[model samples]
Target chain A: MPVDHKRINGPENTIPYKLYTKLNVKSFKEALQDAVKNGVRNDKRKLDEHRRIFMKTDIVSQAKGSAYIEIGNTKVVVSVFDPREIPNKNEYSLNGELYCEFKFAPFSCPKRRLHQQDAEEKQNSIVMKQALEPAVCRHEFPNFQVDVYALVLENDGSALSAAITCAGLALAQAGIPMFDIITSVTIGIQGDLKLLDPMLHEETLCYTSINKNSKTGKNSHGIVILSLLNTHQQVTEFYQVGSLDIDDIEECTKVLTEANKVVVPLVEKCLAKHVIKGVKESSQ
Target chain B: MTLSEAEKTFILHGVQENFRIDGRNRDDYRPMELETSIITHAFGSARLRLANTDVVVTVKVEIDVPFPDRPLEGKMEFFIDCSANATPDFEGRGGENLATEISNTLTAAYSSNSVFDYTKLCILKGRKCWKIYVDILILECGGNLYDAISIAVKAALWNTSIPLVKSVTIDGNNVDMNVSENLSDCIKLDISAAPLMVTLCKIGDHCVVDPTSAEEQCSQGAIVVAISKGKFSTVFQTGGGSLHPLTLMEKLKLGAKVGNRLEEALSEALSKIKENGEMGFLN
Candidate 1:
């Protein structure tokens, strides 16, 4: 059944996307308007340039590992549950581990979505699992699978980015040893500008620009999904530009390369504080 | 609550001694946390967490042709989704029954003219009208779901800013709407008469408001009373257990009293939202 966007009874949380409305297929007009409104400003920064960020772990006492990360208005809480045995073997992957869910709760949208899981949610879980695989040395914790749940409690834009950033923090909070801390950043291009951390409005109007024949726009309009290895301060896995081809891959590496530079120290700072807190708590 | 002997003894002793299960008196309400304007893209929305129960409500307004029979009346629909966040039992398609029941109750409660004036929502008789959609999401079920949902819905309605529709044109059967550009020129729904739900759980001979999950499991039955303007908008008696007419009447009285208090509290909360206000989940 087609989920009616307006009918879903969730929360009345308004996410500002109306700032990017297109009159027609000439989405360039809207993109240009947005570029003028948000892109041209001196505040418009590029990929690899990171915002001041912070994260904390063990905020939710009950959760196995819970952490909160903030990237401007994008605040997310990620929690990791101890690896549990699979309920149904039929659905299991090659590895014994299974079960991952990501959700922007009903109230997370301006127009509430039905709380039931949908294709978008399923796709997000896959992305989350893929980003997490490289960071989590799953071989040691075999026969069991950890549930990495990311809740976008507040989304300014770049939720996928926040999810990657927050997931590693949660794993660390849960005391799960990992090779590195993972951070993701989304970069969108509109004409002569590249916007770092495209807000909810920017992402919505992005597709319309692709509908137009702006090849250069397509190059910059690409998305870079990166997972950071905290110790190495490196990009372990990268997923980018599903719709665009090799030639159309406008801007590459800058977002992930930049994200690694900006995000590594922030993650380390949080981890150090968490370690100190754990020692203090155990002593108490 | 149809408590076992030991449980009954414990509760009675606690109530008499001024300490109930969650360590509070009979009249004590659960802690409430409310977050507003969180949904950045919605017309208006709010989340209310009363204890462990979480309710998220959003309001969306769309223009549509008014019903032929009710030419001057607009449309307002209430839909509730019993989400899995409440419990594992609500996973997948399992929560439909509870969701439908809650939505039906909300529909009935808001059916009265005094509760929500549909006529005011009309643009042109039989030509154009504003249909307000109120969507409710139940996240966690600590207890007192009805009360939390109702309060959140009311607050969301108050926060709703209906776009100021400019000069609606009707040509034969076709209707053309012109929307105003002024953001400040918006109509706010007057929800002073909006109904508040009071869930009265029958625990032995007494009835309790806002019963916990264990208390609910122990109860024989529960009655949902929707009160607006000090009048009964709807009374829904749910669960399998039956009660005598006299007992039902007594429960109705308790519901009425509780309903009044709820209405008062809701109005006070909504008014405070208009003034300098502060609330969130961190507390």
Candidate 2:
């Protein structure tokens, strides 16, 4: 691996001290079982309830459009830059291309992240681009490229969905033509319990396959993230990990779609506030 | 590759008529040839050729400590390298995006423990474990890269023979193990539940599997579904276009059906493979 001199690099193989702590020494299966008690999450949220979201537009003055969003402990900021000519391509493109970058702050997670984008971040970038592309009117700005950057300040959970939601807001704030507002949500399934908008710890537990105690060989556990265009009722991007039956997936999608609907009005209200403020300023 | 508008329209019309540019129908796949144990140096390797698309997958294993969170499970990683020989666009870091996408998909597809048992690879609980590295090199790109790569990976894994461990002794923080030196004393991976990816390209209101480059250019959207043991291990939407919920569900069902048939065909072909000498790119 190439050394990054720009930022202070930690020791080559420094594990998080939390791993050695007594509280976390227990097996993940035990921890997973303890995550939810009496239909309430560790953080005291309902099984299908989402964390309160705080959103603001035009936070970054330098960018053409920018939005900052916070869902519980997860904080993400997205910025959209003005359309520019394609960098290396010489051929004329019939549709505008989107360049998306998803990054995590070095101190975002429990463990220190590298300055460079890792495999997970790169994959998230592609997912973000796919989720936002269908909503953007690429034909409106043919032969141009729009750059979108998402930075996770603190990743508690559902950072990718938060970034997707923020990116849509940023694009709308930038006055980019769009079909509809794009909202995204993540659902984590563990056995028969489904946790909507899973926190970081809950997400990790769902990702680990530790249903050895179950009598049946099949165990349902996974994380599903879906991005929806509200007006069109289309799924722009869907990504899933872990083992899930088709029936489980069908139920999860239905739950996720409803979860996305809950977020649509919140996002629209934020954008509406921005629009109303802009109109008031121009009128004054 | 860039296609002319006229060509795109022609392909679109063909898809609408249920006849592809090639003689194959919408669901039919091109002829594919698979060869395993091609790389002698690697523990296991396979090369697959699906018409103009070519992929070489090699599996190498190394002993390492398991993750603290999931100590009972070993690790499996997928790495993709797009050779410049396949296309000029893949030179330098140009292929990084495509490489990352394919590797990520493979990673997710194989993440399920039931699909490829990770506990079998663990030598000791919370201690030593085998980390399998699946490196895929794309020698050519026709289209339907996901399906070809996944099939080649499964074949390579099937050919892999993990060295058997005789015993292990741990003292405080130090650990030692005895591995069998006999070449024949090895364990084979149970890959029956290994997932196979099928890409369903939506073109002109119809879905097609194993599309060629020409047909790929005409697709409005594409869904890559990874099926393992008749269950969905992963489902991803690629490309720029979006699809309605109904269309997405329809394509997922179609992909699963095609994936199961392809899985059967591949396993049968794998069983028929003989230890033929002097095989590879040379042959």
Q: Report the number of the highest-lDDT candidate.
A: 2
Q: Taking the tens digit of each residue's C-alpha lDDT, what string does model 2 give over A63-106? A: 99999999999999999999999887867888998899999999
Per residue, candidate 1 scores C-alpha lDDT tens digits across B1-283 of: 1346788667655555656699866556777877776675677899999988898999888888776545678998887888887887688877775776577667656754546778889998867899989989888888778888888998888888898888978787787888899987899888887878888776665677887776676565677777666655555555433444345556666777777887787677666664324444653
* Alpha-carbon local distance difference test for all models: 0.67, 0.90
| lDDT at B98, model 2 | 93
* Pairs of residues clashing in candidate 2: none
Please tell me which predicted candidate would have the highest DockQ against the true structure. Answer: 2
What is the C-alpha lDDT profile of model 1 across A241-265, one tens digit per residue?
A: 3122222222434444555667767
Model 1 DockQ (Cα-based): 0.01
* Each prediction's DockQ against the real complex: 0.01, 0.75
lDDT of 2: 0.90
TM-score of 2: 0.95
Which segments of candidate 1 are over 4 A away from where they belong?
Answer: A1-284, B1-18, B274-283
